[model samples]
Target: MHSLGFEPNEITYGSVLSACTAFQVPIFGKQVYSLAMKNGFFSNGYVRAGMIDLFSKNCSFEDALRVFHDVFCENVVCWNAIISGAVKNGENRVALDLFHEMCCGSFLPNSYTFSSILGACAALEELDVGKGVQGWVIKCGAGDVFVETAIVDLYAKCGLMGEAVEEFLQMPIRNVVSWTTVISGFVQTDDSTCALKFFKDMRELGVEINNYTVTSVVTACAKLAMIEEAIQVHSWILKAGFYSDAAVGAALINMYSKIGEFDLSMLVFKDVGSLKNPVVWVAMISASAQNQNPGEALEIFRKMLQESLRLDKFCISSLLSVIGCLNLGRQIHCYTLKTGLVSDVSVGSALLTTYSKSGSLEESHKVFEQILERDNVSWASMIAGFAEHGCADQAIKLFGEMLLEEIVPDQMTLTATLTACSALRSLQKGKEIHGYALRIGVGKDVVVGGALVTMYSKCGTLELAKSVFDMLPQKDQVARSSLISGYAQNGYIEKALMLFFDMLMADLAIDSFTVSSVLGAIALLNRSDIGTQMHALIAKMGLDSDISVGSSLVTMYSKCGSIEECRKAFDQIEKPDLIGWTAMIVSYAQHGKGTEALRLYDLMRKEGIKPDSVTFVGVLSACSHNGLVEEAYIHLNSMAKDHGIEPGYRHYACMIDLLGRSGRLKEAESFINDIPIKPDALVWGTLLAACKVHGDIELGKLAAKKVMELEPCDAGAYVSFSNICADVGQWEEVLKIRSLMKGTGVKKEPGWSFV
Candidate 1:
């Protein structure tokens, strides 16, 4: 107004003062006040009222009082202005004091004065003061419709919803605005159902809802996910001609997206394109991602970037889901880097996600390092990368680093970390993580809960797994599957079966993992009947085609001693992996069907299935059971040379047992001595047992001494030494071995059937 050359009028100053309050710019308000005073408008009640409104709107009550006192004669409107400003700006005590001062100066209070004082009481949450204002209202004869509306709003906000309703009932002339206030109050209080009923009643009385009414109603629909009701409200908004109003448009986008009506939301957005603000765009983009159309969201986001609209947290998060569309995601990541958006916490977190999805953990780490500010989400993404890349130790180390930085981990971090724990079988560290999770309230968290159960089960902590499962506040099919897998892993076949049956009876949707867990349990039990039932379910669910489930079923049937069923399941798998072959071979070896195990091992090689260390163990075991010492030796050396798998301890143990059982003690001894790695106690014990069988006293005694040095209290070693001495008629030596055993108090445990 001043730029137009004429002095700023009272109306312009009022507008400017309101602008200053809205923008939270107190300095601009002061500048305006100076200009007004220079124009001799200081004594102007309208100008002074604007200045008082400016000061009081920012909780500058002292300045407001100074403005009020400098005025020659403050009128009722001017007094109401300062009081209303003070109340809304969080100066409740000052508003009440000014009210009492007004009454003492013999200035009769109006309905506005009473309403302002009541609102102050509501802001301060002072029920006593609110009731006091009501008493004053009665005594001052100010109980009009407007005064009644303000008091109702105050009561409703202060949690006295009943009193607010009573105030409404007592009003003589209730307007549409007054009814809208009560409905909006109910919405804010989370009573959306009551708010909807009140809205219906207002419409039944032919009271047309303005923009605010439809906006609040749509927001409530969004919360309840009531698509039908939201559509009706949108239609009402269209009929009321508020379709293009920015607030109403933003609410419609959010409601439609939340209700899974992305198409309708887009239509509304395009219709209100001119009025679509940044919030509206964010809502639309988020809806697209939630509806699984992340590509479309990215396209829209590109347009937003083109228009130079600044992105907020939601905008960046929504775009991150499209990372599966790698080409587009890379472009976005580059754009983020170029624009220096990588420093933005949300954007940087999204960048981490994109790199993780692209299998570029190195790039993700680079981006994460560049983030000026990071949250747990960013830390979690980096940790998950380590887990995915088979770097469990690195994952654990990074988790420790996160703690050192004093950043609190949330549930997502816990879930990712448990994967690394299970891989390493680091039961000790995993338990400590579980303790921290419980301390931080992550125990009942849904995503983290199932993983915790899985980790404990994998680490042989069935009791802990069961405790975690039972303590869950709610359990979905994923949780049930995780618990069942835990039981199966820990050899609790009966418990696993019980949980699977219960899950089925509850009518929960069973995925491939659920079937796989049950099949594994049945396999462990060697129950062909249960395995067949699971196989039938696999066909019923049409999950026989999924590689993971099919492979598990193959393994299960093999372990149940049904070679035919195992072959059938294996053949049904479109692509048989090394796991399927290993399962069949190991099962045959276990049942002493050495010829069949050898034949399948050869077939696995001919079929181009890569053999792992476990496969070698099974193949070598087959040779041992059949007394094919030559064959076992050949495969053992071939394992490392051909397959590049270093002969692990189990492989070497099988080779030693094979040669020793065949009475090739010298050859076994030379093989043990020549192996690339040092032999464990089991290797030496195998030689000792063989020497005893052949009555080779000297060799047996020597092997036993070596074994005892490794494991001094080993009952097998003592027995081998004593047996050898007795076989050679060395009574004194036998007595000496017995004396050593008695001194250590070590008793040999009886052999029992293990599950």
Candidate 2:
């Protein structure tokens, strides 16, 4: 019309500006504004309202406000436009202020004004303000379907589902938006049963369901893990031809995976027309990884790369979960850097976890530092990586830094930090974190509660640990097991046993750690009767084959002096790991079955199980017990050469005991002198015991002197020195030693036996 030389009027400008606003063409809207201004049509209310709508909808709220204030007169249309725009731009409080200002002025709020204000209320979760808005809606009689639906949404989003449902039932007329709002609300609140029920009611009423409704229903099914309801929803989706929608297909895939039907998820993936939708691809990848099909997940990602589909943050994060090696993880990390997706918090967090799990904590920390904006997940991932890699101090330091930056810790962050505190045995830091959890109102969350229990138990604060356990709303296996393990570790064997029996009485599922802890308590008690009953229970529960359980059984039987039962438990293990083999060898050594222990050590080496420092301790002890001098010498030499294990104090003590037992006192004394590290009192004390056996008076005096110098308060050294003197018929030396003990104020402790 302008090209035809027809002069544009206020109506003409207003219609064009409205079109621009509807299409979100801000540049064109600006050109129209200039044209309207030049034509002197700015004074017209129609053109003025159109310009405000155009600027506000396009998120130029300042320009919209300038246009509204420039006009001498304002209407409800301008007020509604600016308020709705503020809410859309996430300036919820500003929107509320604008609404109050408009209400104080001459303009009466229409249904559009009330709808926008209710939206601001929902965004802010301002239930009280929303109730006031509902009252205004009734007073003005402006409760149209749009306003009523907004009211429903306000109550729903605020988690007042009862009010939401009541409002919905009172609405004389309802649209698809109202039904979808209530269904999606229930799903968001974790009331999946109510969500599904609402969907069924909507279907029975013959309301046309949209893609959003179907997606919500599928999400509800996934949460409930109800495969039958999910299948029915899938059929309905197919009949409605909504299967072609990407979001619905993704939801169905996740639902099937949650129900443990990965094959059905695969079938749905093949049927989905959303091959180009990154959402569907991400869901399939996550489902495959979650269902233990990482290989398949990786293959699907390869196909996605082949298809040249754009990868979003969810796609990158899901792919990261399936990565099993550092090389593959680095490849993905390089890709993310090139695509500028590394700046995304989710992708950065995923990379951190992948590197951490693949034993590349350095790379994980580097990734964490490169994150442009660190969220709670990024901080938590780095902290957990430090804890997992045994950098407890670094983990604790990073947690403190996160707190200094005012990053509110989530459940995962608190739990990971607590784990680091436990590893460091920093009881003070653990208590501070517990206080933080309580302040944040997540103290009763089961995951955080269990972590608190573990942290306290590890720090040897059993009273605090039990308090946290008792405060937990639900006693999960982790909390119960941690408390039992703490009791056993602190010598409260009867308490541990009682808790184990209570767990059995309650029929709560017990994992291997719990059983192992109970076995440790039984071992401390030296009660073969209880151990036998535990063995029978283990067989019934099919936990006998578990390596940890088997190892604990071996140790328990050995402590009870039942070597045969220990061997039987060891034999039951199909493939013993390092801990299992070490347990059996140590048990045999303790029982004086040194020949059998040596045979098992040989068999373990042939089976390619490497011996650690502790393993050598057991091997050396067996040799000492059997008086195998030549074998002990060979094993001691091989410890550094073949296994790269520097012999510790225990290994040296075993050597001293062996040589002294064979009457080779000179060799034993020379060996102690030749130790690379300064020997502890235990090493010299071992030599003194040997001297008493061989009647080597002068060497016994030298060993006892070294022992006393190293440990001045050790009564055992004095007693051993006196015993050695008495054995050699040195009555004068014995009397002198007794007089010296009295002068030093040292008294011998009374000995007791476990039996």
Candidate 3:
């Protein structure tokens, strides 16, 4: 067209310059600008507007402003170009400043100008400013097609769904983009039902759904786990032939990942072939991590490295998602070391998480210390890293150091530090951390707020936990679950139920975590009615698939003496993880089905599901409760010698109880002595109960003696010794046990049956 030599004018030069800007050919645009200047076309407002558009499009807003300043004939278009350029480049503050300058310069902002300013206001979270701009847009009588869409987007981003809806309804014309913006807003608020309804309404109105439309609605579906709707959206994507568009591909990837459809997510990722967008990579990585399939995330990361892309901050953040898989985590650390990505704070933090989760606290510390300057986030991350790895003291010290440095700890930092406090049972120190957290507005953080509730509850400060829980303006599932569990943990079963019902009133969805929390309350009450209602709720929600929820259900039923229900739930689980298997086996053990518990334990081993410490605790308990003397010893030996469990206190307690109950009193004593480590009061109590059952007064006395050393004034131990002495007709010994309990300044708690 240029070769035709038909004298090119302002529009022609503008189009050509815009093309150069789009392609980021700044040198070529500059050459054209110089040519336009020599021809005196720079004086033309249209030509100057084109130059501004070119620079802005190229993400060079400064260059755009330079062109605007040189224009002899400044107009509304030139000002709009400059303002729009700032918005496009994410220089929102600058865009707002320039808009103010334009308003004062006697050039009234047009509809497009108002839209750009609204975008800047939205980004700045200046909702009032956005409303003011909207008013001007209306007063100017330019509330047209493009303006309506822009306003919708601005309000949607600002979380003003009601106002966004009002704008959409009042608009003379509503397009697919405008509707999509509204749907996205609802999705952001987790109001998927509203989003779905709006999408249906758009379709009924004969709105032509494009890739963005489908992508927008798919987000709502994913949030609600609306599988059918998501699949339908996926089908529409195929029909629109938008499978190739990165936005469509990313939305599909995110949807599948959210719906527990990792296979489909991978299929989308592979079909997308080479994801160029770092956001797409993050979606895939986060999906894999969220689904507990870190291996796929790792594989994707490797493929990502092969592309013509450098791992950015998000790439490292994505890696952090899969640190639960220790081996892969270490591999990532090594990969980071090789690729020089360790210098980046995001990658460094991810590496720290990987090392910490893998029990390599020292390595995590090494990486953490390598960072010369740390942000509050970095300090929080290190504190969390230390706490998760059981380096409680270090976690506490780091939190203190963060304070000394005047880095006001956020919720994450305080929560992690409090977790360390809980692990150490440092109520005094935890209170101090809580005090600091309160001063800094830490309660706004869901996890820290929830952790504060649990920490105080665990530390036996129920009132303090109540205070924190009461102060939260909004309590999501995590917060509610934490508060409920804390209540149940502190024996406030009724309070837990009250909170659970309050959550329903708040319309918060009862997820697996919520059910699991209620299960704790059920366990505390041991009430069949509450347990049955909870089970019904679980069934209604189809949360039987959730391992934690399933485990909790089994536990609740087991404790409520509904062993048959526990068995049914256990049997229905398709592929029981160790926790599930342990829960079921423990249920059987609690119900006195020792052989059945042992059978499940064997089945677990046969399935290559190696039993963890909790698994062994149940197995040992089965043997101890049912007096399976030989079986207990065999399992104990297997746990230590074969499985390398190195029996914990509970395991030893199980062994001692098994021996003592079967009249092998001497064997019980020997077993306690032979444990790799010293046992706690629970171990001695188990043996003392067994002695009381067998009328072994001497052995009972010995067990009671050990209990007093472990727990200086154990009322149960005193009762057990007194009972054994009475059974053997030793009245004087019983009186001595009572007198000794009193002399220790011990106050025995009254036993009250729950149900």
- The top-ranked prediction according to lDDT is 2
Candidate 1: stretches off by over 4 Å: 1-367, 388-390, 403-408, 421-442, 459-464, 588-611, 619-645, 658-664, 688-698, 717-740, 751-755
Clashing residue pairs found in predicted model 3: none
What clash count goes with each model?
0, 0, 0
Ranking by lDDT: 2, 1, 3
* Better candidate by TM-score, 2 or 3: 2
lDDT of 2 by residue, 184-248 (tens): 89988989999999998998999988888888899999843587888888998889898889998
List where candidate 3 sits over 4 angstroms from the true fold. 1-126, 132-151, 165-310, 319-324, 354-365, 370-379, 388-393, 411-451, 475-480, 499-508, 572-575, 625-630, 640-644, 676-712, 715-755
- State the lDDT of candidate 1 residue by residue for 1-755, as single tens digits: 45678766788887888888789798989998888888887887777887788787765767888988886545776788878877876667788888888777868888988888987887777888788888888988988877888888888888777778888878888887679878877877878788889989998988867877778788888864577778787788888788878778878887887777778889987887555366667666767767878777777777787778775555566566544666766777777777677777678788777777777778778888898767788889888888887888888999999999998898888888988998888899888998899898887887888888888888888888888888899887777898899888788889899999998888889998888888888878888887787888889888886777877887887777677777677778777678777877887887788899999998988998889899999999899889998888789889878888888778888887788778888988898889999888888888888888888887887789889989987898998789788877999998898888999897878889866
Error of 2 at 628 (Å): 7.3
Residues forming the 10-long window of minimal summed lDDT in candidate 1: 314-323
lDDT (CA) for every model shown? 0.81, 0.90, 0.81
TM-score of each: 0.54, 0.73, 0.71
Off by over 4 Å in 2: 1-201, 216-239, 270-274, 322-324, 434-450, 466-482, 495-519, 529-558, 562-589, 592-676, 682-703, 728-740, 753-755
Alpha carbon deviation, residue 710, candidate 2 (Å): 2.8
RMSD of each: 10.8, 6.8, 7.7
